[model samples]
Target: MEAQRDRLVTLCRDAGIGQAELLADTLSLLLEGARVSVQSVGTEGPSARLSAC
Candidate 1:
């Protein structure tokens, strides 16, 4: 995860990505993981945050 974050930061830097766009996208996997993990425990929370890859 640490390596992936570093790569993402590097990729964004190299590609000149804006902070807002990055934040909007970076949380996609977070929400996905949260949703999938919750399914295993048989519980659902309020609407999850939306994000794009």
Candidate 2:
């Protein structure tokens, strides 16, 4: 997870995005939330909307 986050941060930074760390963290949280949501409520639940975001 740490490695993935680091890669995300590097990618964001290379793309010249400001607050790369924060963006990576936010993405991580969103993904984790989606995983939990899917596990608890199945793919047809609210987690399905995550792809629309």
User: Which is the leading candidate under TM-score?
Assistant: 2
Clashing pairs in 1: none
In candidate 2, where is summed lDDT lowest over 10 consecutive residues? 44-53
| Model 2 agreement with the true structure over 1-53: per-residue lDDT tens digits | 89989998999999999999999999888788887898889989888898678
TM-score of each: 0.40, 0.75
lDDT of 2 at 25: 95
Taking the tens digit of each residue's C-alpha lDDT, what string does model 1 give over 1-53?
A: 55656666677777777773475357556655766765674454422332221
lDDT of predicted model 1: 0.57
Query: What lDDT would each prediction earn against the true structure?
Result: 0.57, 0.89
